[model samples]
Target: MYSVVFQEICSRYGKTYSWDLKSLVMGKKALEAAQIVIDVLQLPMSKEELVEESQRKLQELFPTAELMPENSPEQEWGDFWAERTGCAVPENEGLELLPEAALGTRDVFKPAAFTLPDDAGRVYSSLPAPLSRSPPHAVQCLVFEDAPNGVEAALTAGMQVVMVPDENLSRDLTTKATVVLSSLQDLQPELFGLPAYE
Candidate 1:
């Protein structure tokens, strides 16, 4: 989805979007990514202009894209986690899922009460009573992430992270993850001391 939009943006300026450029921006916030692109490409546009164009292209392209394999429509994510953990994970309680609109592309660039590593701590703090009455130490948390930044955030918060990284990402970038898998389908819960899938 992002690559298509990026390609369109690059083509407009007669610049080809390369894998190297994609890697640099892969896990960055939208504004940060846009700035990087402009600086790297020496594009004749402001970061805001690039971001707006990319967002416009994304909005058009996203509707036609298929859901990621992990986001199967038949299984609600909260329920999936609840079943796997044998614990209640009601939305916004044991688990909080925010839509893209809630965290706007621009919102992440600014300092916030909750961000990245701190957000990981907040999530642990906000776990429902059934999940943890007292704040469970961050060491008790297991995070599943797809980006190097997210893995770093989980580790910074003292949690282990299972990373399912993009195939194009460098192996060196994946070294910090507790475990790395090519896809979510390859995950083995029992390996992490979680119950095996029934």
Candidate 2:
């Protein structure tokens, strides 16, 4: 659907997106991507205007659009991005922490193994009870989520969240995130007091 829309935009502007340029735009923030499209295609529109028009077009097309096909490309990209960042990519699935090999090298090891919202709340409540001086407080931990439910759970636990929602997610829903990003690649660890990439 996005490809179709992008093609239409290109057709209208008499331009084409190369694979390399598309890759650059893939993980950029919405406005950033809009600016790239407008600039690269030399479209006769401001970034804000392009964003508004794109949103309007998307709104009209989304209801009738088919679901995107499932693929491993995005998963591969995520793995590559995480490795490049030197960050452990722990899979925080239901009540489980599927830490990768690199996780063992870390000095601290506290997995956020929560299956449900109630479980998350319990974890948050217990943090200050046993160790008030140490870290892992709700405010100190930042949640990076792609799902709306996960965002809600983290917010409910009083933790700040940086949500990298799928493109199809409603704009209204994205506001629930403390910060919304296009991808993990766009994350600034320094903003959360984590070590920045050199």
Candidate 3:
């Protein structure tokens, strides 16, 4: 969705959106991402203008958006927890912790703070008290991430992260992850001291 909107924006300036640029902006905050795009492409518009135009286009496209096939398990996991807890678990449980919320700003993009390198460790450090009666230390936590930024964030928090990167992502960007796999299906929980899948 972002690529689609970015392509449209870049096309107006006769610039093509490349995956390299996408990688840089992928996990950043909206304004931050917009600034990177503008600076890198040397676009004529300001960050705010780029963001506004992108948002307008996104609103029109989002209605027909479909969930990625790989994300189906996330929904299943939410449903499983909701069933056991007898409380509604939203599919996007961490939405409230997005940078937009933290910065008191609103945007169509919803990158969670946990995906931001500087904020990830801080947010993870604070999760224990509210979420558990006996919270484990940061080192005891295992994170599952699909982006390099997320892997960096979890590592900064002193947690091991299993990265399931997009196939097109550069190999050099994946070296920092404690573990890397092509898909979640390829992950063996037992390897990380967690229970084996049934």
The best candidate by TM-score is 3
Q: Go through the candidates in order and give each one's C-alpha lDDT.
A: 0.60, 0.55, 0.61
- Candidate 1 differs from the real structure by a C-alpha RMSD in angstroms, to one decimal, of 8.5
Tens digit of per-residue lDDT, candidate 2, span 1-198: 455666676778787755444544543445777788887778888888876766666666655633223345544444454564432222322122212332443324344443222344533321111112234343456667665555665676677788987776666766878999887667776787776644
TM-score, predicted candidate 2 vs. hidden true structure: 0.38
Report the poorest 10 consecutive residues by lDDT, candidate 2: 124-133
Ten contiguous residues minimizing lDDT sum, candidate 1? 88-97
**RMSD (Å) of each candidate, 1 decimal:** 8.5, 14.9, 8.0
Q: List the pairs of residues colliding in candidate 3.
A: none
Off by over 4 Å in 1: 68-80, 86-139
Q: After superposition, how far is residue 23 of candidate 3 from its true place, in Å?
A: 1.0
Q: Report how far off residue 35 is in candidate 2 (Å).
A: 41
The clash count of every prediction, one per candidate, is 0, 0, 0
Ranking by lDDT: 3, 1, 2
Across residues 1-198, which tens digit of lDDT does each residue of candidate 3 receive? Answer: 779989998998999888878877765656778898999999999999998888777767665655435348754543343343222111112233323322233222223333212344422222211222123443466666666765665676677888888887888988999888887666776887765554
